[model samples]
Target: MDGEYHPKSEATVSVYDHGFLYGDGVFEGIRAYNGTVFRLKEHIRRLYEGIKVTRINLQLTKEQMTNAIVDTLRKNNLTDAYIRVIVSRGRGNLGLDPRSCPKPSVVIMAEPVAPAHGKEAREKGITAIISGYRRDRVDGTSHELKSLN
Candidate 1:
């Protein structure tokens, strides 16, 4: 998706993009309230921290990234919604080398969501969704980094 905005149906990334090819990326789930993004600065700070550790070279400053997210919410005319911000190592070779990627890909998405739970759970129970992603801990020790990869 890069820096430009597009309809979700038309959004895409190259097959060779490291994020797509190897799941090399980081993401944050955010929320908005009444036309204002919640804790946007904190989220941007944390996202940059992850970028620091991952060395993904997002090519956009934290401010730029934050603006993108806010703009996405506005574009969709969404409030009280769940937001997802993703940054990935851009197009690269089929090999495992990070050097192959130069620019990185970025995507921001938002949608209305169900409540976090409580009354809904008491009444209708809950549904669980399983993911194909597998996460492994080092020697059963937890890491501070939460990631999509």
Candidate 2:
């Protein structure tokens, strides 16, 4: 994390990031409701679990990350919002190998969002389509770990 607040338009990540190159990263989607961050600890725990699985050496402790989330919210003067926390493999030379990356980049964004689907859809049910492609199994590639790509 850069430790500075930037406007959404000004926030930028390096093109050399391994996350952008090879999708080496993890993320969590969080919500703030009624002035409280819903399931904050659970979200942090899941994020750490992903980091452990990906073997990304995040310099900040879990508690610090949690505080950072709060700080970001305070800086933005927001409540009742959606928060996206992303930790991506840091910048490195152009190569598929992650060993070239020495750090991880963290970004947290908060914004207001209304429901995308209508209430009638929930009540009447929505159509579904099945695809031939399937996700990689947990043993092969953990679905629990969220990748930016």
Candidate 3:
């Protein structure tokens, strides 16, 4: 598997990683079109905003993160792809203190994407199911933050 991409064997975080314990992190999903990354700037902007809202300190500049995504796509010889960007609270002890988590974990992954639906579905419209779960109040979770959990 010399040229093949391999998943990380073990993903680890510190005992105090807020993201690991409290789900205090944000993420973004992006898509690339042809050989160009679509809406990349907007995606990064949103990520920055999310970080600011969540108070997660990302070490990399937006430009660096974007370049990393593009580099991965090029390395894999992929044109149409999906990208996942995440910022997590750095490792720390089991305390509810932000100062303990000094450095933040930044991860970017890019991979090819294939949609399941065909043109017929797009033209005819698709059926959707309503979920029983209710969305969190904007005031409580600040709908703007795209963090999981």
Candidate 4:
């Protein structure tokens, strides 16, 4: 759905949407703690960076998007939850051409999510090591859009 809020069961995007058709889009996962959206500005900034690198001409500015998120949380009466902001290239033909899609679509979804592990698990803790695998090729389709801070 474009800019309107809809029930989860009613929310949908066209099959021809480039985002669905060819993975032509980007998104961000954010969280809210208590009554505040955590690192909201940073999330918006990073989201915009993705939008910039993907060349998606969003109809709303960063301020508007932030307002939208806050409004959504208010409407949902959610203070603590997981949030997802998804921007997809709108409907298009079968081809992989960006021009096929004129406008982009945005969807913001929020839901209460429990911690991945309970207090017992947290107390037990776990150990891990960083993966040596690199997800991108510097000379190829690297996902780096902005310099890491």
TM-score of each: 0.78, 0.79, 0.73, 0.79
Total backbone clashes of candidate 2, pairs 3 or more residues apart or in separate chains: 0
Model 3 error, position 32 (Å): 1.5
Q: Rate residue 61 of model 3 by lDDT.
A: 83
Q: Name the top lDDT candidate.
A: 2
Native-referenced Cα lDDT, model 1: 0.81
Tens-place lDDT digits, model 2, residues 1-149: 45778998899989999877778888999998656789999999989989988888899898999999998888888877899998987899998778789878898999976655678996998998999886776579665667666
The runs of at least 3 residues in candidate 1 whose Cα sits more than 4 Å from the true structure, single-residue gaps closed, are: 114-144
- Backbone clash tally (model 1): 0
The TM-score of predicted model 3 comes to 0.73
Candidate 2's C-alpha lDDT?
Answer: 0.85
Local accuracy of candidate 1 as per-residue lDDT tens digits, 1-149:
58788988898889998888888887888889777888899888878777778888777988878788888888888877899888888789999999999888888888976557878696999889999787875667335344557
Each candidate: how many clashes? 0, 0, 0, 0
Per-residue lDDT, model 2, residue 23, is 83
Candidate 2 error regions (>4 Å) = 114-143
Could you report the Cα RMSD, in angstroms, for every candidate shown?
Answer: 5.1, 4.0, 4.7, 4.2
Cα deviation of 3 in candidate 1 (Å)? 1.1
- lDDT by residue for model 4 (17-38), tens: 8888888887878899776999
Error of 4 at 124 (Å): 12
Candidate 4 yields a Cα-based lDDT of 0.82
lDDT by candidate, in order shown: 0.81, 0.85, 0.75, 0.82
